[model samples]
Target: MANIVAGIGWHVIGAGMAASFYAPIEKVKKWSWETTWAIAGLFSWILLPIGVSLCLLPSFTGFYASIDPHLLLTIALFGAMWGVGNVSYGLTMRHLGMSLGIGIAIGVTLVVGTLVPPIMDGKASMLFTTRGGLYTMAGVFVALIGVAIVSWAGHKKELQLKGHLEEFNVGLGLLLAVMCGIFSSGMSFALHAALPIQEAAKSVGVNPLYAMLPSYVFIMGGGAVINLAYCFIRLAAVPRLSLREDLRQPGPTLRTNAALAATGGIMWYLQFFFYAWGEANIPASMSYVNWMLHMSIYVLCGGIVGLALGEWAGIRSGLLRLLWVGIIIIIIAANLVGVGMAYSQ
Candidate 1:
């Protein structure tokens, strides 16, 4: 019971990290999106994963020596696809605004990432048979409802702030957002596909907390590779946003921007840093639900971050109240998941 509670706590903390990572990037000045993103990606996806892997999984050469190349390739390929999702996620918000875009994106991620892996693994029936798994599924559905409420509230808030949504194109934005969700679920798939690596880590006596580190190398680093490719392409296409010149500039501007971007990078990496710890506590039978729990908390905390940044400024009390209601429901939903996991354990 206690372990499950701690796992939920870790997930909340991880989601909070995910929610607020972009703050530092927002403070970055005069840098193109590609520049800041690439730098942040180094920390979130590549540098940090490698650094932590060295720390936790010490015998890097030995670890990979035993694993099949096919598994690594499979996981990395999924991670690469997930990289595309990371990019499209921003575009979704650009097209649909925070509320509706987030609602749809997170909802899709919750459903797809939660169900697909188990179905693929032929363990879908366990979800139905296990009382705890059923409760967790219930919590996921409830979280989806909360997500809808929050998204609706955000849509209402936007209306109150602006006369109308500037990016109200239903056809294009909706399709793009759905595509983003599908790709976002790839990270879940990557981890699912890397189950053998987990056993290898255990065979090598790796601690539970650190077992996921090596997998992150293949997964997160693989995603970073694609992101780097995209950013480099954008940089070449737009000479004005040349990251080379930005890095060449001397003094505080470059240093300050780099520092801010790096901070954001660290913050971004912490999402999964904490996720590893959180999953260590989840019951194996109920583990498939972790993605749902994660996406659910992410949306909720994102709403809280908006509130903190005064994004809801001058909002009508009714919509504001609706946002609060949704926030409450999400919190309850997270607790319900923890409770269900407890029973399953």
Candidate 2:
């Protein structure tokens, strides 16, 4: 019970970090989005991960030597796929806003990430026969319903703001959201596929808490390739959007924006840091439920933050009511998953 509580706490903190990751980006001034995102990715998907992983694993170089080349490539490939998903998710947000993009993409990610592994491993029967499996499954479906409600609220909000709808493309946004959802599940798959690496770490006397650190190196490495490539491509296509000017003549704005972007990236990386911690502590029997819990809490926290930031301000009362209802459902689903985790333990 104590371990379950601790795992839940870690996931909640990770979710909060994820929900608030964009706060610092709002402070970036006089920097192109491409430039700032590139800097942020340097930290989130590259430098910070490498630095932290080294701190966690003193012989990180040796650890890589121990992993099978084929397995490492497989994990990296999964990360690369997830990187595409991450970019698509950002595009979805551009067209759909926080509510709809997050709700739809994360909903699909949670459901698919949770179920596919067991099915692929030929343990589909466990989903029905295993203790707490039923509750976890219920929680997943309920979470999806919650996401649907939230998506509906977003659509209604769009209707309320129809005068400003010229720039929004619901169809494109939904398609990107679905694609993001499918590919985002790759991260979960990467972790599962890298189980052998984790086991190797454990055998080498590495603390179980930090065993996953090395795997993240490959995961983030592949992500860095995609993110950096996209940012560079954008910068090249629009030279004026590049950070060359900012770099050549460093100013207060450049310094501040770089710092803000780095901060955002570090915070973004912390989400997965905490996620690994939480996942490690969860009982193996119900560990799959962690994805659902994380996603639900992430969306729920985002909804709360969005409300606090007045993103829903000046909205029609009906739309606001719908948003609150969706949040409540998510909260309920999270609790159900938690209870299920406890029962599985």
TM-score, per-candidate, Cα-based: 0.81, 0.86
Best by TM-score: 2
How far in Å is the alpha carbon of 122 misplaced in model 1?
Answer: 6.7
Query: Taking the tens digit of each residue's C-alpha lDDT, what string does model 2 give over 1-345?
Result: 898888989999998888777667656777776677778888998887788767776587887887899999999999998988887776776576665566666666666665676688897786788666777678778878877887788777777777765645667777888788788888878887989988887887778877887688888788778878887898889857866865654577778888898998888898998898898888888774576568778887777666665666788887788877876676677666656556766
lDDT of 1 by residue, 1-345 (tens): 998888889988998888777667767888887888899888889889888877777588778877899999999999998988887765665555454455566665655555666678898886778887787688778767876776677556555656455555445555776678778878878987998898789778899876876898899877888888988999999857887787877778999999998998999889998998899997886674465577667777766666666556677878878877876676566666656666755
Question: Which candidate leads the pack in lDDT?
Answer: 2
lDDT to native, each model: 0.76, 0.77
Off by over 4 Å in 1: 92-104, 118-148, 160-176, 248-250, 285-293, 327-345
**Model 2 global lDDT (CA atoms, 0 to 1):** 0.77
Clashes of each: 0, 0
Q: Name the regions of candidate 2 deviating beyond 4 angstroms.
A: 122-144, 162-169, 238-240, 245-250, 330-345
Clash pairs detected, candidate 2? none
